[model samples]
Target: MFAFASLLALAASAAALQVTQPSNSSGWTTSGPNTVTWSSVSTDNSNFSIVLNNQNTYPQYNEVLEALIQTSEGSVAVNPPSGGWVAGTGYRVNFVKNSQDLSSLLAQSDDFTIEQSSSSTFSAVPLLRPARPRPLVPCQSPQPAPPPLRRLARESASNTDSSAGSSASSASGSSSSTNAAPGLNVQTGVYGLLALLGIALA
Candidate 1:
C-alpha cells in the first residue's frame, strides 16, 4: 500500500510539471496561418516552440515558422535558422524547455502533406468579432429645396415686362400731347399779320 501511494504521488508530481495550454479566459487569441499561441500561461518563464520533421520533404516549413511567429507573441527566441521546410513534412511543438540542444523535445510522427501552406493559427480562445459600424446622421437639417429657381426666374421676368410696359405707355402719352399742340412759330406769325392789317386800315 505504501509503495502504491508513493507511485501515485510521484505521478501526480510529474503531471504538475507538465506545461498546459493557456485558457480561453485570457485575452490572447490565435491569428494568421499555421500558427497558434498558448494563452493564460506566463509568458515570462514559459517558452513556446515548434519543431519540423522531414523538412527537406516539405517546402513550406520555413513559411510555417514565419507565419507562426507572425501570429504569436512571447517567442523569446527561435532556432534552426529560419526559412526551411518542404511538403509532406511532419512537425511538433514543445511548450517547455528541456536542454540547450532541444533533442528531447516532442516531434510529430505523422507527415503533413502541404496543401497551399496553412497560414492560420490554432487558438484556444474565441475570436473577437468586429463591432458593427454606426449609421451616419446628417450634421445639419437639410435645407429645404431652394425656392424653385425656375419660378423665381419667371417672376423676375414678369416684373421686368410690367415695368417696361409702364415706361412705354408714359412715353407714348407724352409724344401724343406734343403732336396735338400747334407750333408756337405759326401762332406768332398769324398774330403779327392781323396787327399789321389793323394798323393799315386805321
Candidate 2:
C-alpha cells in the first residue's frame, strides 16, 4: 500500500508538471488585412520579444510592429513596455506600419508570419474582450421640402453656359491679339533703327 501510494503521488506530480509546462513555441495566422493572430504553445510569464520575420516586404523596416493577446476574457495592445504585452498570457501579435500623421496605419496586412525561437517560452494566450456598442438616440422627424428639379437644372445649365461662353471669348481674344503681329513687328523695327543710331553716336 505504501509503494502504491508513492507511485500514485509520483504520477500526480508528473501530470501536474505536464499541465504547467511553459508555452515556448509560437505560431501565427493572418486575421485580415493588417491584422494577425499569434498563438503560443504556452502562456508568457515575462514580456515576449517578437521580431518581424519579413521586414523587407513591409513599408516599415520591421514586420513586428505590435503584438496583441486575445484570450477568453479580452484583448490588449502590446508595443513598447508602457504599451507592451501583458505577462503570463497567450497573445496574438500584429505587425503594421507606424504612421505618425494618420490616426491609424494606412495599410494593414501581415506580410509574413514568424515563429517563436526554441529558446523562447510563454504561458497561455488570453482572450479578447468585446467592444461596447454605442447608445442610439431617437431621431427627429423631417419637415417637407420643395422639389429640387428647377433649382438644380438652373444652377447646372447656368454654370455650363457661363463656362462655355468664357472659353469662347478667351479664344476669340487670343486670336485677335495674335492677328496684330504686324504692328508688333513695325515697333520692333523702329526700336532696332533707334538702337543702331544710338550705337553709331556712341
Candidate 3:
C-alpha cells in the first residue's frame, strides 16, 4: 500500500509537469518571434528543455530547434534561424522537464503552421478569403433613351420656312415701292396719245 501511494504521487508530479500554451492548430510566423508556453512546473528546483519539432521531417523525424533552458513558470519564445521554418511547414513546441530518467515527455503542443505571410488565412497556405460585396444596380428603372429629337427638329424647320416666306414677301413689297411698274408707265403714255389725237382732230 505504501509503494502504491508513492507511485501515485510520483505520477501526479509527473503529470503536473505540463505545457499550457501553444494550443492545437496554432500558427506562427516563420521569421517572427514565437512563444512556447507551459504550466504546473516547479521553478524552484527543476529545469526545462524546449524543443521545436518538424512534423515534415527529413528522414524519419526531425528536431528543428532545441534548447536546455532553465525551468520557469511562463513561456519561451524563439525567432527561427534563417530558413529554419518555411511556408507550409508543420511544427510543434515541446516542453520537456529536466529529469533524471529523461524518458518522460512532460508536455508537447499540438501541430501548427509556420507561415510566410501573416494574412494568408493565418495559416501557411491560404484557404479562405473574405467575400466581396456585389455591385448594386440603380434603384430607378433604367430610363429609355431620350426619344429622338426629330420632332423638335421638324418644328424648328417649319418655323424657319414660315419666317423665310414672310421675309421674301416683305422684300418683294419693298422692291415694288422703290420703282413704278414698267407696264403702268407704258399704259399711261398710250392713253395720253389717244386723247391728244382726238383733241387735234376736233
Candidate 4:
C-alpha cells in the first residue's frame, strides 16, 4: 500500500506541466481564438484550464485574464477578454488544473504579445460631400436686324431719279405740256385755235 501511494504521488506530480504554444514570438490578439497547447504526462481524462497574465505582474500571477473553458483537451483555443489587453508585448500564458485555484498552476509559457483587435481599434471616418454649383445669369433680349445692303441701294437710286424729274418739270411748264402731247393736251389746242381766229379777223 505504501509503494502504491508513492507511485500515485509521483504520477500526479508529473501530470500536465509543460506549455508548448504561445512561444516567445507568438502574437495573440485579444479578440481571437488563439491556440494554447501544452503537454501532459497523465491520462487524457485529466482536465485543464488556461489563464492570461502580464509579465510585469510576474510571480504574483495577479493580473490574470481567465479563459472560458475547462476541458481535458491538451490543445485548445482560448480568446482573451475583449477589454482585457492593451497593444503591447510581454504577455504570458498560464496552464492550470483548476481555474478557481491559482496555486494549482500546471504550466507556464514564455513571454508572448497581445494586441488590440482590428475590429475594436477601428474608428469612424467622416464622409466627403460634393460642392454646390453656382447659379446661372439671366440672358438679355436680342436686337433687331438691319435692312440688307442690296435693298438700301435700290431704294436710294429710285428716290434720286424721282426728285430730278420733279425739279425739271417745275423749271419748264410749256416743255412739260409738249412732253404730255402723246395724251393730247387740251390747254395747248384751245390757245392755238383762238390765236388763228384773231389773225383772220384783223
Candidate 5:
C-alpha cells in the first residue's frame, strides 16, 4: 500500500516539471522570428533559458537557435540563424532551469516541424503598382451638317430652265427668217400676184 502511494506522488511531481510552451507536436514558420510560449512555474528562481534544436538527424541534436535568456515572459522569442530552419525538419525546445547548484532540467516539448508558406518568403518585399492612364480630350467644336434641298426649290429650278429653253428656240427661228435674201422674198410675192390674176381671167 505504501509503494502505490509513493508511485502516485512521484508521477505528480514529474508532471509539474513539464514545460507547456511549443505544446506537443506544434509547427513554426521560418519566415521570421518565432514567439514560443510555455507555461511558467512560480518558483523562487527567476533565471531560465530556452533553446530550439533540430532533432532530425540520428544520434545527434543540432542547435538551430542560440539559447535565449527568457524575459519576464513565460515565453521566449527566438530567431534562427540567417539561413533559417530546414523545411519538413523536426525540432525540439527545452526550457532549462538556471541555478548555481544542480539545476533541474525542465520539461521538453514534443517534436515540432519547420515549414514555409509560398507567401512567407516574399512577405517583406514591396508590391508593384499599376500606372495611371492619360485622360482623353473631346472635340471642342463639332461641324454642323448642311441643310437638305426642299421639294419646292427643285420644282422652281426645273420650271425656270424650261421657260429659258422655249424662249431661246423661238428667238432662233425668228432670227433665221429675218436673215433671208431680199431677192428671194420679192420673187415669192410676184409669183403669188400672177396666180391671183390668172384665176380672175378664167
Candidate 6:
C-alpha cells in the first residue's frame, strides 16, 4: 500500500514539470524572438534542451532549438532557423533532459501555431494623390464694341445724301459746281444770250 502511495506521489511530481508559457492559446511567428517557458519539481541546476516539433505531419518533424539550456530559469527566447519555421498549427515545444544517448523527456508545451511573419504578410498601400485640378478653359479675346446710336444714324444719313447727289449730277448733262447756288447756272445763260442780242443790234 505504501509503494502504491509512493508511485502516486511520483506521478504527481512528474506532472508538475510542464511548459507554462506558449500554452494552447499562444501564437508565434516564424521570424520570432518568441519565448518558451516551463516549470520543474527538480531543484537541481542541470541544463536541458528545447526542441520544436510539427505534430501535424505523419512522421512528425523535430528541430532542436537549443542544444543545451537551463530550463529552470523558467523561460528562454528562441528563433526559427535561417529560413524560419513553416507556418502552421499543431506545433509544440519540448524540453528534454540533456543526455548522450537521447531518451529523457522533461516537459512539453501544448499545441500552438507558428504563423508566417507579420512583415512578410504585410502589403504596402498606395498613397492617395490629390485629384488634378480640372484644366482651366482658355480665355477668349473680347469683341470690339458697336459704334454709338447717334454716330451710326449720322453716317447713314450722310451716305444717302452723297448717293442722291451723284445720281442727280449724272442725269443733268451740264457740268456745274454742286456746292454753288441753285439759280447761278440759269442766270449765267440769260446774261450771255442778252449780250449776243445787243452785239447783233449794233
TM-score top scorer: 6
**Superposition error at 150 for model 3 (Å):** 99
User: Against the true structure, what is every candidate's RMSD?
Assistant: 14.0, 30.1, 13.8, 14.5, 17.2, 15.0
Alpha-carbon TM-score of each model against the true structure: 0.29, 0.26, 0.43, 0.43, 0.46, 0.50
If both were scored by lDDT, which would come out higher, candidate 3 or candidate 5? Answer: 3
lDDT of 2 at 61: 35
RMSD of 6: 15.0
What does candidate 5's lDDT look like per residue over 90-188, in tens digits?
677765664322134565677877777554653466878888898998878877765567866888899999999999999998887777667688999
lDDT of 2 by residue, 1-202 (tens): 9999999888654432111111234333222122223322233222222333333433533335433222222223323333322232233332222322222222222332333334323455898889899899899899889669999899999999999999999999999899898899999999999999999999
Report lDDT (Cα) of residue 201, candidate 2.
Answer: 100
Give residue 90's lDDT in candidate 3 (0 to 100).
58
Q: In model 1, state the lDDT of residue 59.
A: 59
Q: Indicate the residue-level lDDT of 129 in model 2.
A: 89
lDDT of 4 at 110: 88
Q: Output the lDDT of residue 131, model 3.
A: 92
Work out how many backbone clashes candidate 1 has: 16
Candidate 6 accuracy as TM-score: 0.50
Worst 10 residues of 2 by lDDT: 15-24
Give candidate 6 misplaced runs (Cα > 4 Å): 2-11, 99-103, 120-202
- The alpha-carbon lDDT assigned to residue 175 of candidate 1 equals 89
Error of 5 at 138 (Å): 41
Off by over 4 Å in 2: 1-137, 141-147, 197-202
- In model 3, what is the error at residue 145, expressed in angstroms? 93
| Best candidate (score: lDDT) | 6
In candidate 1, position 73 carries an lDDT of 54
Error of 6 at 99 (Å): 7.1
The per-model lDDT (C-alpha) reads 0.45, 0.43, 0.66, 0.70, 0.65, 0.77
